[model samples]
Target: MCTNTKENDMDIYEFYSGRSFDAYRELGAHVKKEVTGKKTVVSGVEFVTYAPNALGVNVIGEFNDWNETVMERCYDGSFFKVFVPEARPGMMYKYKIYHRDGSSMEHCDPYGFGMELRPAFASIIRDMDTYRFHDAKWMKNRSVCQGSPLNIYEVHLGSWRTKPVFDEQGNPLTPEEIAESNRVAESWYTYKEIAPMLAEYVKEQGYNYVEFMPLSEHPSDQSWGYQNTGFFSPTSRYGTADDLKEMIDILHQHNIGTILDFVPVHFALDGYGLARYDGTALYEYPSNDVGYSEWGSMNFIHSKGEVRSFLQSAANYWLSEYHFDGLRMDAISRIIYWMGDESRGVNDRAVDFIRNMNQGLKDRHPSIILCAEDSTDFKGTTKETKYGGLGFDYKWDMGWMNDTLNFFRTLPFVRGEHYHDLTFSMMYNYNERYLLPLSHDEVVHGKATIIQKMAGMYEEKFPQAKALYAYMYAHPGKKLNFMGNEIGQFREWDEKREQDWDLLKYPNHDSFHQYMKALNKIYMKEPALSAWDDDPNGFAWILCGKENDVVYIFQREVNEDKVIVVLNLSGLVYKNYHFNYENGDTMKVLINSDWNKFGGSTKDTEKTIKGVNGDFGFDLPAFSGIYLKPVD
Candidate 1:
């Protein structure tokens, strides 16, 4: 039977009122040590769960030989708990919940810190305190990075780079043998094994942060960890919970921040998971019309206090326990309006829950970032909650992503008609603290890769692709690019195979890689590009209304330091083209996308040009971009 104490009653009140942010500490399987008057210590594990609708509950696991041990109900008749001296770390367990109709079902613990791999559905006992992190200095100095460069490299760990499979003789396995065996497990590198490799690669590539797709325990690899079954459990496919901790620790040691992709809207519909939990729709909405999401998963009913507490606690658990620097909340538009349809009216209950959760998380982790991946034009997504906003530090600019990609995909002859698509983003750039993303979503499911999306022949595509990237970097906002984007992979991203790293052997692809690396370096080193990104005075358009010329010129400035960007999207070159500039300032070419070294035909010449009487002239190559900075 469970021990009853006044402290437990208070915790239950807080949990049910949606006020407990650290509910994992009180609800899950916790290893405890009790000291007696004789100064000897007794060690045991205590299990706790909340199931108000259940008639009774039993704790059954390996320690008890899978036999049912009845749990004691607390005074409130909502929570059940049991203490077992025989329970040890690494033992698997589940709660057997008995419905009022005398039917019983075994369910994995919602707050379990570790879970079994797929095809298995048991929660494992894990010691969360075993791994000590050595990232105190990184943790202490971390911030939202509002005024600093925030170039992110988004990765899907499972397919980033798979390990080689070996047979029983310690030789590399043949293709037939790998196909016959469990290829999924054979290809994956554990979290600890991939830490150093990932750190070195990301640091070398010049990305300051790495945003991984959802890492929570899920049933389908195809879902990419979006449909979670265990909210608090890190998926065991990567390794044990401590292994994931070590991965984050290694990233911090390399001075790179880690951001977790969190899903707060839905859960997997697998029967063994949260579906009909406790013999009732406790976590999800009672009706299918509003309960099921468009992705065929259960929608969390945030109106329930218990549901809010469960989700908010799960969000807090990752940031507080795992040392993650930020959380990128996914599908926030679904939370703002019913079924993500603005006409269906706002989901006030869900919105309030979001506001409360965000406010609470910020109060707890003041320096950590809270980003929203919302597509709605819903106002104040990055505003403070006290001033009637959603309280996010950054919001993904979906408008900019769609518009810019559409412009690049148009044929050069017809690009004049779509010129405003590139300039439209600035009309509302400051609506929220935006992050410009070229994420994995844009490259998957027949959308084509970034380079492949260009509208031209194979040779013509390279220069246009180079020009597209130059324009993206010079635009206002934070930046994020998927793993394979930097290398100009022609093939779409596939989760089953590793990235086409072999593509680097080709001269065109290799040169594109070098160009991307150089662009990243300039972005990180220049203060004018990032230091005043959110300020209105940082950007100005010198040539926006000329649609027929298929040209764009803009100036990005921070105080006295300034840089001018010129882009030519047409097939015609403009020799000695003149544009208005600051008077008497000599301008030098910083980076030219059409240079021969970057797979272009432009020959090297005098790079510096003088601005006389507020006019600067330079040769603008076809389908090219160049950055010009004022000389001292």
Candidate 2:
């Protein structure tokens, strides 16, 4: 290696991916117990800190020897130090973690506010508590107490844009610059651009909140934000931590809340980062007793004190420094439960710790919302914390997604349609303190697209089924839609692939947009559809099981100016179909799925419907659903 530069010399080591694979993996757990990671300050190229487990971590700078490792890390509990071989501006370095168990790993900085896989690429050393600002200082001005009324728009950074790229390693890449190139085709976008654009779009579309997939840094180019490396930093590929701050500021300016999709369940086995900051034994758990996720990664030792510091710091940091309105914690089901244990994986101590986290965040900032993506039957997740709950404002109703998909998939033409199941979902989906979300998870990974999920007979069935999806929007619960769903995006989400933006030119695509806009009209405009969303009596329905078909009447707000949503789940069109409602002057048709614009020729123009003989009968199109507002 060349020397005579401005830097010193250091030892370099390597642990190929294929070398000691099992041992390498075991090290993730071992550190938590024996030599859990320890953080140390290092004066090397670029001025960065070194964690205890950094294996063969050495400094490489613009000066000094060009070796991979120089200024090797030396430890004294307070901090880790390295000469940086003469740390210089152009100097680059990488942390090398080797396990006493003979396993090795490499990764980027975990606490870095901005980071690259290796060094010299630039990384921000962010201490969450280091920042000082009091913007949303008086959160009490807002009447929305935690879960008063929150409608979230979930987004994934890599897929939300239309540009894509690949790295030298054949890894899928999403460089953040595509946001400004304005290339809505096969590209990635930067935070500086995406924030303003998304805020304006959501403000116009009438959504109150924005939920982003994980923003943490990671090495995998195509990662769906699930595999994380820099827990304390925003992905550098997007922009600096300040860019995210600017984005959130814009969102707040628009009165749209910001929520981060957080993954505290596990940590990526990054070799160059926190994994082996001090030594292999330093932050990680002692043995394999700590579980591993089905997906390849290191699980957090939730019960450990140091682990608690790391995780809690992460949660509170985002809320305070970034001004995030909330956090949607991913995978709570895996946190305190074991697979197939019937939700019996009870870790009371860990559960209490999570509750304490809620108190800690709110104690500092009372307005922060904490939501969970929990699918288990845990009873106290949403109960008041005073009652010994986990203190989450709400838990996602994952069962409803399953029930809805199952009902839609079993088409009568293919598999005999089951009306009872549909009624069952309607009856129980919103039973608990919950939220309903057609999350991004459901639309990808070889599962048929949402439109395809509704395909029954013809491409014609597409819009008809979509009409029912509109009904879902008006359902009595908090509503959430992935980024592209509002415009009827036709492609499966691929981290490496961009959205098919050209599809919007088609009339069908345009119609999907109009259709969704109409549903949101009811969702955002009507108090009956929103304010009382968590109240069940606010949503009551009656199903008349016809011999050849079924008809259901959904009523919102009894003894008041109310809306009635009727679904005709049969193949035949019926005129004067018997339906009864409290005596009202007439009824106005708000929306009908059977329209020529929406790939349907059965156009039913808006009209006033009347009740006859204590029964309101109206023309029902074949396989159609309608939302009607009872008029005076």
Kindly list the per-residue Cα lDDT of model 1 for residues 1-632, writing each as its tens digit: 35587654447667777878888887878877667886745377888888889999898999999999888886477888888898988899999999998898998998898889987888888888889999999999998988888999999998788887887788986444664675866788899999999999999888999999999999888899999989999998889989999999999999999999999999999877888888999899999999999998999999888898999999999998999999999999999999899999999999998999999999999988888999999998999999989999999999999998899899998999999999999999977899999999999999999999988888888888889889999999999999999889888887766788888999999999888888888888888888788999999998887789899999898999888899998878999988987676588788888887787767647577787887887788998988888885
Query: Which residue pairs clash within candidate 1?
Result: none
Which candidate wins on lDDT?
Answer: 1
Winning model by TM-score = 1
Give lDDT tens digits, candidate 2, residues 105-196. Answer: 44443444556532223343332333343346333453333324567888887666543555557665543434334332335577777877
Score residue 522 of candidate 1 by CA lDDT. Answer: 84
Sequence-dependent TM-score of model 2: 0.79
Task: List per-prediction Cα lDDT, in the order shown.
Answer: 0.89, 0.61
Candidate 1 residue 28 C-alpha distance from true site, Å? 1.3
Off by over 4 Å in 1: 6-10, 34-42, 166-182, 603-607
Task: Give the 10-residue window scoring lowest on summed lDDT in candidate 1.
Answer: 1-10
